[model samples]
Target: MDDDSDVSGLRATLRANPAGHWLSTPAPQVAEQLAQTDADFVVVDTEHAPTDLESVEAAVRAVDAANATGEDGAADTAAVVRVAWNDHVRIKRVLDTGAAGVMAPQVNTVDEAEAFVAAARYPPEGHRGVAGTRASRYGRDLDDYYERANDRVATIAQVETAEAVDNAGEISAVDGLDALLVGPADLSAALGVFGEYEHEQFVAAVEAVLDASTVPVGTLATSLDEVDYWAALGFDYQIVGVDAGYLRTGAAAALERYEQVGEE
Candidate 1:
């Protein structure tokens, strides 16, 4: 990555298109394929996926390769890794993989949000230990990377609990936080209305976060309909699809079609 080529573009893209959509996948090949599309970013999910640091690094490289091979010679797609937790070790390791950003899950307070951002930043801003990692081109671009990493790295906090909803404003106000994402499945489950997005309590919690957030707010949308639904409800951005879900749906449809043809 070049000096000016950090996640700044990703941040700018989201700012320009509040309803910008992203895709999440655990596979590097899948991430590369998705990154080649118009999606603003592709998330390599470590939170719920069986992905490790090595996989995250490979996925980030794949996304970068996709951008390098774009038809126009400039692909806007960036790689954002969803770290398994708010721990600094995980956040630092993922960022070192050259991911454009890191999304920390279950951040429910200002302190947690700050910690999340700090882990992605270098000294003076945070305590992220510097190294000649892939992010710095193995010591070749260390100086430039260190100088720009703090500003270039985008930090996102996932609001999944009632406490997060109540503290959304404070969390959003954290200096280095780029965005807030509502983990709908977890948030709903926390509110005793699992999968019931239409439930009053669930709606209220989402609305609370939406209303309190000072930065761009987003959520995960599993289907096309939910895209419009969340957009209408004022979500700033969304992860529109999941790789596993797509595979299952596509395979099922293909089998159903084949069964119908055999019956005919």
Candidate 2:
């Protein structure tokens, strides 16, 4: 895609809409396939999944290709990558792959959030070193990418710890930090109430993060059933399905169907 091409789908959609859903996966092909779906964005999970930079780059290219030729074909679907941590080198590498954004995990403090934003941005804003990566169209769009990247590229910080919840307001207020996401399972564990979403402390912690956040915030729902509850609570985005979840559910259902037919 050209530097002038509308590569800001995820950012623009988040701005215009109240909430959006994203598909998270570790597989590049699946990432490409889902980008063609109604999902607004696809996030390649590099932290938990055994995904390397090469795989992440492939996924980003897949999203770019899928968006290039879909029905409405505005290439509006975005591809975001969730890095393993809030490190400068990792963040810069992924951003160079032309992703719409990078989601940094375990940002439990304002300083960590600032560091993430700095690494994702360029000079004057931060210290991100520029290279002729695919993001710059191999030096062809170097000038344009340099000028517009800092504004267009998103920097999402994950608020998955009790400490982060306490500092949510400050983190959200940091310049260049685009969004905040509460990692439910991790936060629950951090609160000493693992797997108990309805526990008072778990609920309260989630609410605290929600109340403290000043910018767009998001979280991962265990299932589609929980989406409305989260949306009502003011989450700007929700991740409902992971690639593993989809495969597991589908495989289980198919086996159950086969068993039922045999019993009949």
Candidate 3:
């Protein structure tokens, strides 16, 4: 929140900001280390990890530290959480942990997307219950929190299935939905042409989402070539793999070179 990088307004930044994500291992050090990278944001993935409430809290704190300490306490980066699903309990928990946004996964239809917003948003506008959480600063400023949260916390719908692709337009029509986030891997799997998103059909699906989204679309691209590709295609937000990739790549290359030298 201190960053002026309104999680809710990330779509606006995508016009100029090149946001990215790194998968952290539910460890504060991991998140902190990843935060030190050049990415605009760090997405805390709780979907595949055994991240409990406490770990999520610590990860946020670490990211905040990484973001805050960098430039005279100016907010350099943001901490977001990808809740396991679009469930209320998980959504509330992540928000309580001070996540600037929630990435709801496996969205297959418009109704599911609507439900996600409803569960994440606070009353009248949404069914989300008011709570004394860290995100709201423990009810210390409930009114201020409510007034800002409705506009501050972002909602990202992960388009992961074939059905989601078919209903992209309807899903994108939902108000308060920040970005139409696509999970290309799951999409490939569901298409029955696993890992073949480069195929014509998959590419068409991507185009359909792009054509339909009222807001800017977000995705995870694999390489610099891919980043250039997406940028040309008008994708506003993207994650260019992880910090681990760079580290592991260099480490493996170094190990191989060392082995060759020793053998020589």
Candidate 4:
């Protein structure tokens, strides 16, 4: 409801060059801190993180607050929710909480992609349940919100299987689908090469999705080192680091420094 920020820019950014972090830590404060980063957007990974709707809503609020006065100009960081599943009930809950986007994992076919999009949208476009939730300013921004929801809310379908890669084009072409994300680990496993990032078959499957996608494509870089690799491959977006990964890496470095001091 904060009209001052004009977050519609996120829609364009996701379709263009989205680069950001993944909030694997299920905390609202973490979302607030990361939203202030130079990243273009951040996705709260509810699929893997033990995040409930309350924390997810809090995180979404934090993101909006951070973006309100963020120095990134029109490139403000957007908050996306990676819901636990593609179920309409769960997707509707997240949308009602005001997340800028919703990402569903393991979307392996055109029907799955369509279902994801439908859940993210309201009537006329889809059958999402309406409510006077935060997204509509608790009824204050009703008319405007309803009119803009379909256009403003982004829908991302993650392609994480061999089947998804094969049907990437059809999935991407779904009417309301905005983007396709590749789940590298799951995808590689399905291709019979778990963790083999450079295996020929795994690489081919990734390329297959990339080549077939009609929308912006994204994948996890797993580390800061691989950011450019994925980006250079023509990926529209890339998640360079996750909250848990950052925490572990920082903690390990600190312990190493302490050990060096003890040796000295």
The candidate that wins on TM-score is: 4
Q: Write the per-residue lDDT of candidate 4 for residues 1-264, one digit (tens) a residue.
A: 113233255666676676888998777889888988867788988888889999899988887777755364443778889999889999999888888889999898888888888888789989998889998889898888888777777888898899999999999888878888898889988888998887889888888888988788999987766786777667888888888888899999999999999999
Tens-digit per-residue lDDT, 118-168, candidate 3: 887888878887888877678887888788777667788998887898888
Query: Cα deviation of 190 in candidate 4 (Å)?
Result: 1.1
lDDT of 1 by residue, 1-264 (tens): 113334454555555444333434556788878777657788888877888788889888988888753463334677889988899999889988988888899999888988888888899989999999998899899998899787667787999999999999999988878888999999999999999998999998888888888788889888888888888888888888777777778899999999999999
lDDT of each: 0.81, 0.79, 0.76, 0.83
Off by over 4 Å in 3: 1-17, 69-74, 260-264
Error of 3 at 87 (Å): 0.9
lDDT of 2 by residue, 141-198 (tens): 9998899787678777998888998999999888877778888888889989987877
| Pairs clashing within candidate 4 | none
Evaluation by TM-score, superior candidate among 2 and 4: 4
TM-score of 4: 0.91
Better of 1 and 2 by lDDT: 1
- Candidate 1 TM-score over all chains jointly: 0.90
Residue 207 C-alpha lDDT in model 2 = 83
- Count the clashes in each prediction: 1, 0, 0, 0
Q: Pick the candidate with the highest lDDT.
A: 4
Compute the lDDT of residue 145 as modeled in candidate 1: 85
Residue 42, model 1: Cα distance from true site in angstroms: 1.0
RMSD of each: 3.6, 4.0, 3.7, 3.9
- Clashes counted in candidate 1 amount to 1
Instruction: Estimate candidate 4's RMSD in Å.
Output: 3.9
lDDT of 4: 0.83
